[model samples]
Target: MTAVSLVDVASHLPPERVGREYFERYSRPDDPLLRNPMFRAPEYRRYAAREDTGADLVERAAAVLFERHGSDLAGEIDLLVTHNALPDVPFLGSGAEIARRLGCRPAQIVDLHNGHCAVFPYMLGLARSLMRDTGARTALLCTAQTAGRIFTQPGVRRSAHAAVPGDGAAVGLLRASGESPILATEVRHYPDHAPDVALKLDDGRLYWEPGTSEFDVAFDNSKAYNIIERGSEIVPEVVTRVCERIGATPKDIDLLVTNQPNRLLLRNWGAALGIEAPRHFDTFDSYGNLFGAGVPVNLDHALRAGRPAGGGLVVMAGFAGAGELAAAAAVRLPGPDRPATPTTGGPR
Candidate 1:
């Protein structure tokens, strides 16, 4: 039997760190958003240069993973999946370009558009199922969030949302080997909430309309409340459900990684799960919100800081938009020997 196992994770955060005050030129010190808990900015967050597109960040991150794993990994990938928050071009994904640049010709590629901020688990689950059915030996999954580009626009630079996110990309290598077997993956979608999130302009002009000014994300007070309420509820629920599938409780999770949009949500999630402060980790302060990329980037940061990703269990989870989608994935870290034990999920 073949089981998909996580090889390792790598991330590339643009080196330029911007402080909250950077938004002052566009906004104001007395701005109500400054005092709002959700909009309260972190001390500093990384940003990609204006010229840097989402594909650029993904390439750099994937390059780091390839360098660490050696050049041979480039040729071994038979499947590639990419989910970029701000793709370079409209109406197309960056999968083909990424695969081509990385020398993964003849690779089957997927450009996922729906999963949004908490898309990592969706990527993982899809990769596992595809590799299993196709008998593919290796797969590369990538996610990039270009907040630097989106927030810097004339339409949004002054808004509090501009200060709440960072720019970065992350990549994870999964192979048919079970050195660190994936225990389970689960996902749920809520189409009703999808419309709750949309673009906002100064006037009624549509995004593509000629008269449309720079647009920012906008929702009414009630919808905004629902988004927060739903996220707070669904994130922990999915994580707990994932734990149950593997015959473990939240206490068994040695490490928990999740999308870090704000400090409140991060705190609430751990408390609800009964997970200790030390057991759960987030990069909200350092990198801010990296969208769906947060899961892999945070995981990489934790592992590099010597957090134990091995010798125990780890779970990653998050919800996209208000609750348009939610997903969670669990993995059993290998012991010192890193055995090749199989999971029943592989191509049956």
Candidate 2:
């Protein structure tokens, strides 16, 4: 039995909006995926920073969440989980940094490393296990990414991958409670597809390699194509399996919140899952991909907009960059003993 209920959620998005026009200003007409309508995003939010690290983004996001949900859970947080694809600091853990920043001294801190897309579902299951083992009462599950500095730099500006990533962070407060329970969580790794996405620092310059091949080969544009081909199939499979684990179907889910691959991919995924257009929430179009922060940030967006009605069953699913990893979970919002409250963006 899972012993977790998400009580509140919040995120911090860099105020700057980098639109497609900005990309067009630097893109060549024949630059394949960069300008293609099928893969292009109109704009994405990027946090502007001078010396701040990924830790800063995580702290700012948590602060936003605390501003709204902190008073009640501040002292109750006994566990802290942080996830980030690119840590601003080397060797040191973001989880500990976040815990220290929030002054959660007694809380146990751990970091989830399943890329940016899939950690939410993985974290849910992990949090449940941790609480049961440690007897912790509350867990702060947080994710943030500030890859704009790396992915949008001059070296990447000439590649097809430059247009896909953005920056932001999200924090979710999950408590061990009988209220607003988590029905089930499922995770699977397809390491066979792990080669689809990668980042290499070669020749004194960094390059994001995102694609696959039939045989072992070096980097190129096909890597991106490989991800598109493979991701389209596995993401939906994991979502469905997780739903079945909870004795539910895609039709039974009120809202399907997954990673921000792109608006087109998300729409296609929704269609593949037999979900209606309105039932799925996406921030990829508006914020690009915030990597690990994608799931929680999108969930917060839906909650703020009053989605997944009272007692609604919300399905959260995500796939990481490696293509081998995926996770999904089903949660029912608005506890039976309490009514829906907009303040927490969660069940009351």
Candidate 3:
């Protein structure tokens, strides 16, 4: 097994910040179930990428990571894993595009289509496996979203549960090492609820389909309710499984960061896991649901804010909108005994 080192993480968001009142005035739905109670957010920053595309977001984040690390990362990064929460274009893969933009000619590029929840943890595991088996030195994991583009058109802005989405991109550099051990990683899929949450095209307009769980509705519960309930269940379960596999307990983790659905979900998850409020890093109120970008972006924010201790254990978790997919990873930060290496080409 290869020990993974988290070199560093970088993120980028567009300039325009939109408030909840803007969504309520222009995009709120008529269905009572889809009201602000369910949307449950105050504001989200939109990437002002009117003239740009999803690839631009990915490239910009990659550029930030490279600039922070300097020229050393150019040849050392051997793999590029790129993905986005929503499908922005057909035929072209964003991961490959980012790799091309960075001129990482020797790096193997893999594109993931798992959307928001499963991608980050899944990529972490894959990068570890690739480094272990293929002798790759480093891997760059990136998640980008151009979610604000959905509102560019006129019709169906008030579609069901069409809570305003923010746009952004995040990147992390990982290398094989024991300096910051990634204890365990897991991802699970629940196909039964796959269709409960999705994007649908209707009458030449894009609309979101939320809370349509047929089986759960029999219990007099909304599909959105069931999705949240299932998320509340699975995140903790995966955290427990990872802890047990690594011979660690929930109490042993020093920090927790999960995908941002809303402030309420983060609070509920912290309560269920018995983690203190400060241990969990939250960006929901400010950034909205960044989809796949949430985990890395929040992790970057937490690390920069000095939330996690040196040599401390950090647990990262994420779940899909319909609660159909889930993933978690446990990592121990480098401490004085094992100083973090320069986040460039070489392993610590």
Q: Which structure among the candidates has the greatest lDDT?
A: 1
Query: Candidates sorted by TM-score, descending order?
Result: 1, 2, 3
Per-model TM values vs. the true structure: 0.93, 0.88, 0.88
lDDT of 2 by residue, 1-348 (tens): 546787777888877777766665676566666544335654655754757677787788888777766555567788888887677676666887777677776458887776568888789888888888888878888887876656555545555556677888888888777556778888888878776655455443433344331111123556766776667787899889988988888999898999887776687788899998789888776888777788888898898887875558888887887577888888888745576455434532
Worst 10 residues of 2 by lDDT: 210-219
CA RMSD of each candidate after superposition: 3.7, 4.6, 4.8
Clashes of each: 0, 8, 0
Q: Comparing candidate 1 with candidate 2, which one achieves the higher lDDT? A: 1
**Reference-based lDDT, residue 104, model 1:** 84
- Best-to-worst lDDT order: 1, 2, 3
Question: Over 4 Å off in model 1, which ranges?
Answer: 24-26, 29-34, 337-348
Instruction: Identify the candidate with maximal TM-score.
Output: 1
What lDDT tens digits, residue by residue, belong to model 1 across residues 79-181? 9989989878989999998987888863589999788788898899999999989899888899998855578786587777678888999998888876777
